[model samples]
Target: MQPTEGERRTRLTIGVVAARSGRLAKLGDPLTFVTEHLRRRLRHVVGQGGRYELELVSRDSRSDPEVARRVTEELIRHERADIIVTLAGTRVLPAVADVCEALATPCVTSAFPWQVHYFGRGATRTRPFSWTYHFCWGLDDIAAVFAEMWAVLGAERRVGCLWNDGPQGNWSRHRERGFLPAAAARGHFLVDPGGYREPATAFDDHITAFRDADVEIITSAATGADLARFRHQAARRGLRPRLITCSRWLAYPVDGTGADDPAEAKVASLVYWTPRHPYRSSFDGMPAADLAAAYERATGRQWLQPLGLAHALFEVAVHALATADDPTQARAVAAAIGRTRLETVAGPLDWTTGPVPNVATVRLAGGQWKRGTRHPHELAVVSNSHCPGLRLEADLEFLH
Candidate 1:
């Protein structure tokens, strides 16, 4: 079936690399929902020359770096994707971005802190990346939000630092532009037990250090499994901290196992995106709450934080394609993406006004998971110091 001579259209391929399987597979669920919604709403976009048909090609990274690299290369070389987008963390985003950089494909990613995405990838200020651009909150933002939560709780300024010896860990404990500097500036003393590797089932050593320090707060960027294990072990060892504030893992269901897990009770985490957000989607003018409600109604699952980010990814990508001088030209599309200044479901994103080139930082709030009527667990925004624009839904509660 060929198009009539009067109806010729250019096809633009948008590639998506996500961790659709493995431990981090839950991260891809929201992406799937957003992609499907966009497919129905954005079948074709009017560009410079004529109407352009948009095709979205998604590949599962399997939460493996090597697999991410392979799938990304295949999308570019075989699928001829014009742009690549992902909502993965350090594990897959870096791998996808590396391939996009080498292949000269425009890429957009969120979910991971911008610092980890930029510096962790060996990107220096002088040698800023041209093909890859990232938009997300930074370590400083999370640290400030965590500190605010601790302040609101009026707990001891003592924090038990728990991080894996990965890129996120190194950055979390870095002397500059890390959590330590931010915490010190905010007058919080963090008891550093050093870094541990992931899938670490035992935390006896770290628990002893935190218990010995009499730390009241536990801050970590641990995997769900490791965090649960650490919490269980800490409890059994009678080392109960006043608060267990974490990042990354709590954005999804508790341990990715589901919301019913009792371990998630009163666990605080970074609130990247939630229905309480005041922003609306640029595509449909849907309020953040409405979008979240729709997702819940459609999936029969509780709204996760990535849902807003996943929607924003498409909003930014589609804007770039539609505004490009020539949608078929990768450089032109990349230029449009670089010049993006649009308000999305997550919030306003302006690549031009960045903390650093190739990165636009968003704000983060503090949230605590508690018993809910709508679901087994619900994240209530408890602290909004870093994101003052977002309204606070509840007061910070302690795990103890």
Candidate 2:
């Protein structure tokens, strides 16, 4: 049956998913966060514009590719989602990408760029087809930043890489192809003693291997809970090295309080970035907190990581819709997005080529865990290659 115009109002839904694994029990999941944020932002944008509607559907990928594909099919065919936002790293992104192409809908994702590349071939002639828009920083850019930081610190020699053996691990392995050779050319000894799992049942063997390598610098790609557990274990066993980790480390609240032992505090200085925190003081202005609070007020639970990404996703959707000449056409909306630049609470976001979106600049800063504060040593931007408007140090305050 063909539906009337009024009946189509509720058809626009957004789908979200998270891993349902025991390993991620402590750190809040990303799916929940994205869902709540999307709902909140949709309400705010709708209230002001009164155009489209937003719906949140939850799926559990368990990091499995098949599960991801099934969930995406359900969302597109059953839920009638106008747009889909999938949190990065789940097996679901590729599945959703394929479906979005078949359905001609747009899918915005927050995941490692390399994962997108590994999942399949190009969908778009101009960009990767399947109408996928990436919001996360690319691994190549991350590796380059790490290399730059190592050079600045004068600790470019004796580098060791460690990552969990999964999609992220596989991506890191590819990243090392470029990272190692770059470091080697700079007079550094790069070593891959193999990756380790987080919340690992055993670490004695991994610890022994790291010690034997006598590595001065270690780059880690781990989530908050995993990194915390590994750091705690490393501290307890006196396994200390200058550690460099991915930006995911900043996604969680990192107070030294999370560490059981006081000795862990000593190694905190080794963390890297542009020597400044990425978060802006204006984060308080971000609609995410307001949305989270509203969700709590109604549902009595706080939103988490994935929800944050969802909120950003919805904001992007709203921007695209507002600027779009015709919101109902998927191609038109995608065209608008390509032509527009979104000013988001996370920073100014725009899409570019590569397997993943390129981050023209990284807001670098560092922080330390201090009493009562989750982040100390607040981050300040040392450089931003992409953000031409933010070249001066004083202009960085605008990021807040």
Candidate 3:
């Protein structure tokens, strides 16, 4: 005999692809915390006059593109995941997005800029994606926020750049629409060393050029390892600038940086989300500060920005599941994701109003790492020109 209307139940599976072990492992730290928090919250979601049971299965990408694709395929084919979620950078996120798009599975992600996800995936205005949707700030937002921070510091107009030849670097070095144009609008000159491939061991040539040009402000979006190598080499050559700002660096607790390192003091990056963000989670109405404090207390580690981004990723996923009348249908879930417009811990996300059909932009502020009274090091909001409502916590400090 068929079950009664009140007894009817639907099971929804969510597959997660993250950089759990490898160079980018730091980016995956929040997944465990956020998923544990959601286990109870998502035990049963009431919608469509019936109850839905949710299960989450996670796979580590190991920070490799090939591994990301393989695990995503397994989740879709073997695990029968109704939806997929990933939080990573251009390298691994794009790999997962490609698999979802080809397999016609729905996916949501953040952490990297929208430009890298949209353009790097060969998506154009005429040819848009249907299965993958992303939410994050763009390169232009980073340019505006970084320029504002530099101006506040009264730094010299000459700025040295060290962008790698990745998707982020290629777009950031674009003359007409990249970071330079926005900085130039603020009367700052970028001394670009041009793009170079990763695994580049030495930067003697770039250092000499910057020293010759008397560049006092340095900026880049290189990977954490590459950035560390460049900084070490630059220091040996006595090329320390008054300010060093590296995008995508402040988002995670990478080795030799973040809360435990005093040597990283005064290094700056663009801020995506923070405990101070004036927003609350749609899941349990938990404020951003409370969520961050809980993570710190539970893990016995400093709160990183990915905690908020990762939590908000689930917020969107659960919202999509709840809104879809038929949670088992991929089309229904994808439609709900496309129509998502809810307030989350990372701030409000509206897919209908993004610059592109598959992307939603987030607000950004300029921040610097400083010695903290609470933690070994803490990220301080130094400029909020792009995010006027985010309170400025401190003035931009010079490394000199």
Candidate 4:
């Protein structure tokens, strides 16, 4: 039921944090798009019903931990946010989660896989965090998509993994906890040189380990800069794998953009949400293709995967806010978000049947980047075995 004009106005202040500047700023583009789309949806729905007014207090994580913590503190202490939403990965998400949990605030997040989130970081599945909620594909989905891509490309099953101590990297490198089992289930063994620390200035030891193991395939869950460095260093050290699939090199500030070497032309990664997806916006039912084209037209840049996922973030947030018995109450909003089963522009998100509570997921497809005429290179869906109905737009192609 819509809140009537006679009813009191709910001042729903939302806290939004994203890595808007710094080394990781590239991943924060979704913050801009999410803000725009959320406002549009709110305006469309606010007066028509849910008579509450929306106020967003956005903060830039700056891709730094201390910066993220400080900004979140400001939002909660000064701005008085009713709920919070986090974007991107690693340093920022954990900081926001920690603060929100401490304050007993409802914090919703997307764009990062769940395995690297709270429960994925070694928390037991039986123990559910009350204040935070996440919706994204995890290691299980990535492994399935990668295995399906490998089979489609007819690549060798012997795979090598390079990951860092960070969220995605930690999950990828931990043998029992992550990729090893996912690959092992598909009859592929992952040669892990263990997790490495960033800014280490060298990866020669890791490169040699993969080469020594005769690894025919390479997979990683490193940052964009690290992935590029890994590829460059691997080539110089003569560690050329038949196929290289990665977890985090699929979007802007990286991905196929500004990539000079042909080495980057052949790599592939999991596609959580792409312009080719058949999903649409929950608010106005805007199609994925139209959304991408419009984003490119507005931003004068390539449409990214984060754009869709970020849009989904707001979709989930808005739904939770509107459904809450008391939008002004943090506890009610948190519980409402945990009960999310909304269809988003990215895909269907159901938090009920989680590997852990307060976590939901979307289907993942495999995509490869290559030079094309339409743009720098079109990201064609190369594998969709795990994601039914998402047709394969191109066969897997690798550099020799």
Candidate 5:
């Protein structure tokens, strides 16, 4: 099946891997959804005069780290990937960071907070040497949003925090350091009931303790179906505390159904970058209706927050590559990203990082479930700082 002598081929291979456990179904699952969206976007970009080849390698990391490392190595060394994009958290980041560093290639990771420092720190130190970019929010930003939510609810005096016990969870631990003391100084009590792993079948046990402690609010670092189950179980048992959740939670469907829930429904979420409602914005220029239509036509599904974020990331990446003299060079791409200021669906993004007087730039906004709508209750700008680094603390209490 080889082509004749004069046939020319220009191939640019990019590798993508997901660290989350299990195989992907066509719809519903977060990893699958993200991966498919990325694939579609990549194809569209390529079709629009961008020549590149993209391949996705799915791996199961639940069993062993060495297995994940081996998969990464194969992609880089054997597959000869020009760039490696990982949708894994700490599990894969630490394993591949050194390899990418040694090889002097770019590694773009879509990880939560705990892994941010691993990638961010790596990116900062190895800049122009080995390029690393994190496409997720920061932990400090999460903490700040929690503080603001508690303050807004007038529950600043006492707060409780709950997180999973993994790489993402570890980032929550670091965030508490900055968040708890800030709350305490504001005459609030900070409570950490350790960390709980996902598939939390022991709902009764956790709720009992929070109830006993008279915890007014409970903030969680969990997301997707886990958050829905947590809320449903708590509500059924009458353990409704004021609820605050991480940005990941915000991406879930508001009603626990595909459509939006009623406005009276209660499920508070913290997010980075303001959510694009069906409204107008001068910065992006793309009207809400136009963006929604474009997204629906492109993906064959209604647009949501996560889709918006993914689209924005893809747009930025395309822009960076399009304007580069050598699009395949990792260093050139990184430099382009850092220097270019582009408008995206997620609003304006300045990729450059540096210490400034006002490091607490607003990153996380808040949202709630609307009882009966396709979108979550219109997202609101709560805190003016990034939610990832903020010590997030809030409780979900149902009002019956």
Candidate 6:
């Protein structure tokens, strides 16, 4: 609703919490980029009408849940924020989401799967609270992309679960969660040894068990440091799997400089928002490739995967605000968010027709790190089972 001539401008505050600094520095400051890009968009939007303008309040989670929760409370209580958003993996997002639920505040979150929050909190079939909305690839997408990539590989199906204590790792090892069920649906079985913690000096026991089990494939969702450590240990332990498809580890650039073994050549990963996918931004009609290019040009660092998903959060917020009759009313804004079905930079997000209430997912595709003909190294899109029409650039190659 447009304000009358005498009506005052409504100030919309968006509180964004993320791991802006700390050990997670290598991952890049995703939320900061999202907030900056959103500020540009919101400025153009508010220029259209002086009725409402955005004021984004950002907080650094320091990659800590306690900090995330504290910042969330500060946003709801002190900042009097009309809406809140968070960006990170399972560690920070769920805690902030919990605070939003407690305060009955409308919040949007991303960078982690809905299954992580759902099953981690012991949510059953019944819909729980309804204040927060989450969107990201669930384990189902990971399993699908992995399974499809395996099929294309045409190798032995013996799968080894290289699980850490992370959300994706924890779920993949649990029978009741999305990973195994999705794998079963895809006609695959997993060889799970057990869960391991990160920063371990050795993976001898884990590798020995997988080798004994005759596992040809290894999949994991561990931290980059852990995976790198594991990679070094696997080389030393003589654990060679035909296919090694992992997430998180391959998400960022590791200073390879001669550290990588030849086995690392054909590593496959779950690529959620590759520029090859035909997705367009709601802000400026820029496609994924163009948006990624702009990000890299603006910042010398590589564009992160979370950047696209981060943008989706703002898309949800803007949609909710525009759709609400009175955006100032938190409940009205929350209700509007619940009804969002917009085509965002990530893809088409329809929260209303959800597989789970208050959750929407953009499909994923498989990608492989291959020796680049153009560049030194590149991740080529390989499987498009989940995201159809996404062009594949290379065939799946055996890593070991």
My TM-score estimates for the predictions, one after another, are 0.93, 0.68, 0.92, 0.91, 0.67, 0.91
lDDT of 3 by residue, 193-222 (tens): 777788779988889989999998888887
TM-score between candidate 4 and the true structure: 0.91
Please identify which of the two predictions, 1 or 6, would achieve the higher TM-score against the true structure.
1
Which stretches of candidate 2 lie above 4 Å from their native place? 4-11, 18-67, 90-92, 111-127, 148-155, 175-187, 197-209, 223-239, 242-248, 254-308, 352-371, 374-400
Give candidate 3's TM-score. 0.92
Error of 1 at 272 (Å): 1.6
Best by TM-score: 1
lDDT of the candidates, in the order given: 0.84, 0.51, 0.83, 0.77, 0.52, 0.75
The order of the candidates by TM-score, greatest first, is 1, 3, 6, 4, 2, 5
Candidates sorted by lDDT, best first: 1, 3, 4, 6, 5, 2
In order, what is each prediction's RMSD in angstroms?
A: 3.1, 6.7, 3.2, 3.6, 6.9, 3.3
Give the alpha carbon lDDT tens digit for every residue of 1-400 in model 6: 4457877656777888867887654443766776886676685224223457677888887878898899889988888777888776557778888899889999988767678876676565585557888887788778878888777656337788878766667877667666877776667768887778765667777888887887778888876566677777876778767777886655554445354632254678877886666888877788888777777877776666777887788878877877776777788888888888899888999988877878888788888876655345667788876787788787888753
The deviation in Å at residue 64 for candidate 4 is 1.7
Question: Who is ahead in lDDT, 4 or 6?
Answer: 4
Judging by TM-score, tell me the better candidate of 1 and 2.
1
Clashes of each: 0, 23, 0, 0, 47, 0
**Residue 348's C-alpha lDDT in candidate 2?**
54
When summed lDDT is taken over every stretch of 10 residues in candidate 2, the lowest stretch is: 391-400
True lDDT of residue 145, candidate 2:
54
| Candidate 5, poorest ten consecutive residues by summed lDDT | 354-363
lDDT of 1 by residue, 70-104 (tens): 99999999988888999886777899999999999
